[model samples]
Target: MELKKLLEQQSAEAWEKYIPSLSIDCVIFSFYENALHVLTVNMKDQNLWGLPGGYVQKDENVDDAAMRILKDRTGTENIYLQQFYTFGNLKRSESAFEAYDDSIWNKQRFVSIGYYALAEHSQVKLRIDQYSNAVEWKLIETLPEFMMDHRAIFDKALLTLREQLNNHPIGYNLLPEKFTMPELQKLYEAILGKKLNRGNFYRKILRYDILIKLDESRKGGAHKAPDLYSFDLTKYNEALKEGLKGNW
Candidate 1:
C-alpha cells in the first residue's frame, strides 16, 4: 500500500524531475509502380525534407515511440518496425540542432535511434503535424534535400533491406495481395538495383514453394497474360528460418 501510494503521488512529477535525451527516426519505405518509395515530410520553417521523426516521451518505450511517430505522421500502426542502427557520432548532434530552430536548441542534447519500417502504401493516411508543412511520397532514387544525416540513414536502411531480401521473404511487402511474377521480379530488381536473369530468378523463387498460383491474370490485352500468385505466409516463415541457399 505504501509503494502504490508513493507511485501515485510521484507519477505527476516524474517527467519534470527527469528527462532522457533520446529520439526515434523512421525510414518508412514502400514499393509503388515498379519503384521504391519513401515517406518524407517538410518542416514548416525549413525548406528541407526529412524522414518522419520525433523525440521519445518520458513514459514511452523506444519501440512504442517509433510506432507513435509513424502513426502521428502517416496514420499507420502495427506495421513491421525494426531498429536498424543507433547513430551516436558527436557530429550528429551538431547537425541535428543546426537543422532546427533556436527554440528547439534550448532543449538538452539528444542522440537519435533509427528504425526502418515496411508497409503497403495504400494502407496509410498521412496527418501533417503543426510543425510540418506537408507529407508526400518520393521516389527513392530522386530524394529531395533532407535535413541532417537523414539521407545517409535512408541509404543504410535500403542496404540492410537488400542484404536480407534473399534470406527473408520481405519482397512480398512490396507487392499487392495478388500479383504477377513479373511484378515481383521487378521489385527485387529495383531494390537490388540490377537486372536479374528472368528465367533463373523465376526458378529460384519457385524452389521456395512459398507462392500459390491464383486463377487470375492482367486485365489488359496488349501482351500475354501472366499468372497471379499470392505469398503463403506459413511456408514463407518456414523458408525464412531455413534461409534461401539454392543455386541462383
Candidate 2:
C-alpha cells in the first residue's frame, strides 16, 4: 500500500508540472499527373505558405493531434500518417509568429514533431481557416517562398518517403487501387525524378511477386492497353521484411 501511495503521489506531481507546448506538423503528400504534390496553407497576413500544424491538447496524444490538424486543414481522415522526425532546434525560426500583431511568439519554446500523410489528390478537400487566406496543393518541384524552416522540414519528409520506397510499399499510397504497369513505373520515376528503362522496371517489379494481375486493362484507343495490377499487402509485408532492392 505504501508503494501504491507513492506511485499515485508521483503521478499527481508529474501532471501538475506538465506544460503543454508540443506541436505537430503534417506534411500531406499526394501524386497527380506524374508529379508529387504537397499541401500548403497560405497565411493571410504574412502572404506566405506554410504546412498545416497545431499544438497538441493536454488531453490528446501526439498522433491524435496530427490527425486533427490534417483533417481540419485538408478535410482528410483515415489516411496513413507516419511520424518521420522531430524538429527541436533552438535556433529554428519563429518568424511566422512575428507576422501576427499578437505576441504569439513570446510563449514558451515549442518543439514541433513532423508527421506525413499520403493520400490520393482527389480525396482531399482543403478548407482554409480564418487566419489562412487559402489552402492549395503545390507541386514538389515548385514550392512557393515559405515562412520559417518549413521548406527544410518538407525536404526531410520527402527524403524519408524516398528511403521508405526502397524497402516498403510506398507506391500504394501514391496510386489508385488498380493501376496500369506503366502508371506504376511512372510513379516511381516521378518520385525518383529520373527515367527508368521500361523493360528492366517490369522485370524488377515482377521479381518482387507482390502484385496481383487483374483481368481488366486500360481502356484506350491509341495503343495496346497495359494490364491492370494491384498490390498484395499480405505478400508485400512479407517481402518488405526481407528488404527490396531498387536496382532497376
Q: How many residue pairs clash in each candidate?
A: 0, 0
Candidate 2 backbone collisions, by pair: none
Best by TM-score: 1
Which lDDT tens digits does candidate 1 get at residues 34-114? 788999988665556998887676677888888988888778786778888887665654554453343343133557799
**Residue pairs in collision within model 1:** none
Which residue window of length 10 is worst by lDDT in model 1? Answer: 99-108
What value does the lDDT take at residue 237 in candidate 2? 76
Q: Which runs of model 1 end up more than 4 angstroms from their true locations?
A: 1-19, 96-108, 246-248
Global lDDT scores for all candidate models: 0.77, 0.78
TM-scores for all candidates: the values are 0.86, 0.85
Candidate 2 lDDT over residue span 1-248, tens digit each: 33223334444443443335566778898988767889998866567788888767677777887888888987878788999999998746554454232323323356889998998988888896766778989998899987777888898998888788867667887888988888888888867778999999999999998899998988876998878999998988787777777334
Q: How far is candidate 2 from the true structure (C-alpha RMSD, Å)?
A: 9.1
